[model samples]
Each structure stands twice: as C-alpha cells, then as structure tokens.
Target: MPELPEVEGVVRDLRPIVEGKTIAQVALSETVFTSHDAGKQTIVKNNEPHQFERLIQQMTIIELKRRSKYIFFQLEKDGETFHLINHLGMTGAWFVVNDITEITEDKFRKHIHAVFTLTTGELLVFSDIRRFGELRFIKEIEEHPPLLKMAPEPFDEDACDFFITQSEKPKYRNKPIKEVIMDGQVISGCGNIYATESLFKMNIHPGRKTNRISRERKQQLFQVICDVLQESINSGGSTISDYRSINGGAGTMQHRLKMYGKKQCLTCDTTTKSIVIAGRTSTYCPKCQR
Candidate 1:
C-alpha cells in the first residue's frame, strides 16, 4: 500500500498533470461497478457507474491533496465545489499519458481500471491489479467515515502531543508500540514500512508495550516518523512491490531501507528477525533494536 510519502508524491505529481483540467469523459471498467472479481469489492464506491460519470464528467479539478494514504481531488462544476477521494489499497497506481496503447509497462497497461479523459488531450489512468483500491465522489469529505478518525498529520505542530495523549489512554496502554503508531486515531500516515523503520531507528521493539515507552522516546519517535516520511517523500517514496509515481517511475527509497527487509543489521552486523504484528511483517535487528 502507498503510505503518506507515496501518496504525497503522487498527489504532488498529479497536480500539474490533472489540476485545472476538465474531465471530458469518465470511463470505468466493468470490474468497478460489478461484484468482486476474485474476492475484490466494487472499486467504484458511493454511487452507480452511470451516476458517478454524470457527477464527475465535466468537473474541473482545482487541487489535489493527500491525507494519510488517500487522495482528495477538489473539483468544481458550474460554481459548485465537490470532492472525489481515492484510496490506493496495495496495488493501485496512476498514470498520465496521451495514449494508453503507448504504455510500455505491462502491469500498468494491462490492469487499468479507470480512465479520466481530460479536455487537455491527456488521460489520467488508474490501474489496480488487486482491485482493493476505491474511487468515490462525494459532496463533502465528512460523508466518509475513515477521514473522521484521521489524526493530525505527522508533521503538524500538535501531532506529537496528540500521540502522547493517545498513548496514555487506558485502551491503548497495552497495545504494541508498532500497533500504536499505526493507529489512525494516534497518528496519521504512519504505515507498516514507516512504523517498522521508525522503530528500528528509535531502538524500540515492535512488541514493546506502548505504556512502557517514555514520553520523551515517544516524542522522539514522532520526530523520527516525520523525518522518515520526509526522507521518503524526497526519495519519491518507497516502491516495495507496486507503488509508482504518476509518470511510472519507481521510488529509490527501497535501496535506502535499513531494517524493513534485511537479513542482518548494517550497524551492528547482528542477524535480523521478523515478527507479525497485525498481520504485517516487521523486520528488525535484534541487537540494533531494543
């Protein structure tokens, strides 16, 4: 899944390509409105395909923003402001091209599920092989439930304090440090890869109880999280398996990863270990991570 950095990079790149361009036509695959294809849910949510097309076809994109792992498209039509949201769950990717047949990447060209044809003669293509991603049109953001639980962005001023406060809650005291940071209510946009790397940097084990971590360490962890996310955004975000930029470029951050998928710690030369927390694998150096 594309985390904050990945989604942020995509949103940044998509702005110049898509913003201000009117969607002349909205094309959706049959797989979008149909039932699950091999356990996948309907990719286009919130309305039927024709209704979604009716609402979005002529809307002009004004701006694009990222929240956590989601993308928000600020749209306008006849002086009315509306919103469209996209969540790239696991395998989703976007591409901007003049012609889809000119696409060279197999995964991108073959799995395209939605195409937003712009009056600018460019097509904004959405492809998701796993079909876990979703696109929705809504009048207001508050209509979605998940956005309501999103905490402050990791780089926001009060995010660290919010993290500390959320950690102190009785229900979260016993939660693993890994799980705590990944909690949407505790901190936004810290996903499995970033959480694992941040823990490795802070020398805190993933399974360490949240209450056992000092407030100072939690503060430092928040800063490290910000740093990691910033570094990733700078590096164009990590491309572990399926993440790609709007132009089809893969991120180089994977080469800079320290602990996420290593067999040995580069710092201590200690053998690394793996554990599953919340069904995600966390790789850490036993000697390097406390």
Candidate 2:
C-alpha cells in the first residue's frame, strides 16, 4: 500500500500542475474509488466537470496538506467551499501531462482510473490497477468521517497523545509491539511495512508487549518512526513492487530498507527470519532485534 511518504510525494508533484487551474474534467472510471465519500457520483467523461466548473472554476487551491495517507486539497472561494481528497491505496499513481498526447498508453489506456483536467490544459490523471485509490469532494473537509477519525499524523500533537495512549491501553498490554502499531486507531499511517521497519530499527522484538517497553525504547521507537518516514519521503517512498509517485516513477526507498523483505540483515549481515504478526509477515535479525 502507498504509505504517507508515497502519498506526500504525489501531493508535492501535483501542486504546481493543478493548483491554480480550474477543473475542466473530473472523470472516474472505477466504482471502488468512490468509497472515500459516500454517495458521490462516479465521474464519467462528460457529466460532472461542467457542474464542477460552475462550483469551482475560479477558486484557487489555498493549501495542500496530508492526514495519514490521505492528501487533502483546500480549495477556497469567498462565498463557496469545497475540498478535494485523495487516497492511494496499493497500486495508485498520478500523472501530470501538458497535453492529452503526453499521456502514454501505459498511463491512460492501461492503468488510468480517473483524470482531473486543469484549466491550464494540463491533465492530472489518477491510475490504480488495483482499484483501491480514492478521489472525492466534500463540503467541509473536517466533516469527512474518515479524515475526522484519523489520529494525529507524524508531527502532530495528536500523534504524541496517541503514542502515549496506545502504550497504556490495556488491550495492548500483552500484545506484540508490532501488532499494537499496526492498528490504525493506535497510530495512523503505519502499514505493515513501516510497522516492521520501525520495530527493527528500535531493536524491539515484534512480539514484545507494548506496555512493557522501556521509556528509552519508546523514545528510540518514536524517533525511528519519524526518521524512517522522512527518509522514505526523500526517497519518494518504497515502491513496494506496486506503488509509484505522481510522476509515474517508482520509488527508490525499497533499496535502502534495512530489514523488511531481506533474508539477511544488511547492517550486520546476520541471518534473518520472518514472523507473522497480525497476519502480516515481518522480517528481523533475531540476533539483533532481541
């Protein structure tokens, strides 16, 4: 799945292309993409963009922000309001094209799931072969249930609060730290890949009880999550053999991973093993992580 870093990269690449441009087209080809906003009409070729233009043609993109793995676009008007939200689940990607001709067969014919044409003549295309991504509009951004339910993100105060709460939660008292972190309610944006990487980096056993971890270990774990997330963003996020950035480029972070998917520890050259935590495979150097 595309994590926070991968999604943030997409937001970065999309800002200049569609920031000031009006919506010439809002076309969605997949039904699953509508799951983000209940009852949103599936965007066909000619239906919604005209209506969308009446609603938001001259409006400017005031800000672009992210919550967890979801990218939120704050579009503003003096008298009207609308928000654009995007979620790239597994195989989703965005494409920026100066012209429709710039959109290649691989981007349009093969994987294209949605397209948002900007007034500037540029095309912001969304493609997800897995049909797990989402593009939706909302009246008040804060009213969206999914976004509202999300805990604090990487740098927010809510994240720190969530960390402390999760550490004390009775349900997690005997559960492995990996399982604890994998729960989105406990820590948003931590998918299986990051959960494993975070645990390995902190030298914590995946099966260790969350409540039993030491204060030093908690501090180390917190910093590693931030470090790993920032590093992944710099590398455009791990491709995970599926996701790509907004430029349709594969991420390079996978090559720098220390623990996940390796048969041996790259840092210490110790033999590694995989263990199942909450039904997901986690790899660690038994010698190092214990």
Candidate 3:
C-alpha cells in the first residue's frame, strides 16, 4: 500500500504539474474503482466511472492537498468549487506524461484506469492493477465520511497529545504498540512499514502494550514517528513494491531502511527478527528494540 511518505511524494510531484491546469479531457475505464460497504460491494463514490469523467471536465485544479493517505484536488468550474479525493490502494499510482501517446509505451499504462488530459497537452494518469483505489467527487472534504473520520496528520501540533490520549483509551490500552500506531484513527498514515521502522528507532518493542509505555517514551515515540516519516518523504518514500513518485521514479528510502526488512541490526551485531502484529509482518531488532 502507498502510505503517508509515498502519498506525500506523489502529492509533491503532482502539485507543480496539475495545479492551475484545466481538464481538457477525461477518460475512464468501465469499472475504474471499487469499494466495500456493509457487506456489499460497489463502485467508488457511489457513482459510475463515467460520472467521474463528466464531473471533472472543464474544471481547473486549484490546489492539491493530502490528508492521511488520501489525496485531494480542489477544483473550480464557473466560479464554483468542489474536491476530488483519491486513494492509491495497493498497486495504484499516478503518472505524468507529456502526451497521451507515451502512455502506451509506459509500463504503468497496462493497468491505466483513468486519464486526465490537461490544456497543456500533458497527461495525468491513474493506474491500479488491483482496482482497489478510490476516486470521489466531493463537495466538501470536511464532511466526507472517510476524510472526516481520519485522525490528525502526524505533522499536526497536537499529534503527540492525540497519540497519548488514544493510547490511554480502553479499546487501545492493551493492544500492542505497533498495532496502536498503525491504527489510522489513532494516527493517520503510519502504515506497517513505517510503524515497524519508527518503533525500531524508538527502541520500543513492537509487541509492548500501549498503556505500558511511559509518557516520556510516548513523546519520544511520537518524535521518532515524525522523524521516520519525514526522512522517508525526503528520500521519496520506500519502494518495497509498487510505490513510485508521479514521475515514475522509484523511492530511495527502501535502501535506507534499518530494520523493516533487515536480518541484522543497524545499531548492533545481533540478528533481527520478524513477527506478525495486527496481521502485518513486523521486523525489528530484538536487542536494540526492548
């Protein structure tokens, strides 16, 4: 899945190219995206794929923003404003190209589901092999169910306080720290990979009970989480699998990983270990972390 850093990288790479540009044309596959709701499966945004193609035409992109792992595009049409929300689930990605002709030559086009042709003759394409991505044309992001439900961004001023408060909650107190941090409602954008790396840096065992952590250590953990996420964003995020920037560039953060997928500890000579926490594989240094 494309986590915070990866989504941040995509947002950074896209702002310059897409902002202020008018949508000249829109093309969408029959079933571009899918979602699950109360035991029922449906297309994203409760609209047919073609509806997205119609809603975005002639609209100018005002700004691009990210909340949690979701990307938002502020749009203006005839002086009216709206928003487009996108979630790059699993293998989803956005690719920028000079012309639509080049899309066929790019490997990402094999799964191309949506294409936005800009007035400048450039193209912004959304490709998702698994069809798990999300696309919604929303009038207000603040009221949207998904965006409204997300916790504060890691960079928010009250992030540490939020994490501590959420940790002390009865529902989370006995949960493993790794699982606690990975919960999007507690702290948005800390996925499995970043969660493992941050815990390793904080020298906190991934399996430690959330309530067992001291207030000082909680603050330290929060700081390390910010550090890990910012560093990954600086390195363009980890490309352990299909993640890539808008320019089709692979992220370099994967090479800088200390414990996420390593067999040896970066701080000591002891061998690393792996365990499943909250159904995700977590790798850490036994000696260094705890």
| Candidate 2 lDDT over residue span 1-290, tens digit each | 88878888888877766665566556555453454245453432222543543555556666777778887777777756678777876777778877655655454347676666676767777777776666666777566566676667867756765776777778776788888777766677788777778888888888888877975677678778878888888988888765777665777888888888888987789899988889888888888887
Q: Candidate 2, which ten residues in sequence have the lowest lDDT sum?
A: 41-50
**Among these predicted structures, which one has the highest TM-score?**
1
Full candidate order by lDDT, most accurate first: 1, 3, 2
Q: In model 1, how large is the Cα lDDT of residue 154?
A: 86
> In candidate 1, what are the lDDT values of residues 1-290, reduced to their tens digit?
78899999899888888888899999988766566344445778878777887789889999898987889999999999998999998889998999998667898788889999999889999998888888989998789888888899888898899999999999799989999899888999889999989999999999899999999999999999999999999999998887787868788888888888889988899999999987888888887777
Clashing pairs in 2: none
Assess each prediction's global lDDT (C-alpha) against the native: 0.88, 0.72, 0.84
lDDT of 3 by residue, 30-96 (tens): 5544433243443256555567688889999999988899899999999999988898988788888
For residue 161, model 2's alpha carbon misses the true position, in angstroms, by 4.1
Q: How accurate locally is residue 81 in candidate 3, as Cα lDDT from 0 to 100?
A: 97
> Whole-model lDDT for model 1 versus the true structure?
0.88
1 or 2, greater by TM-score: 1
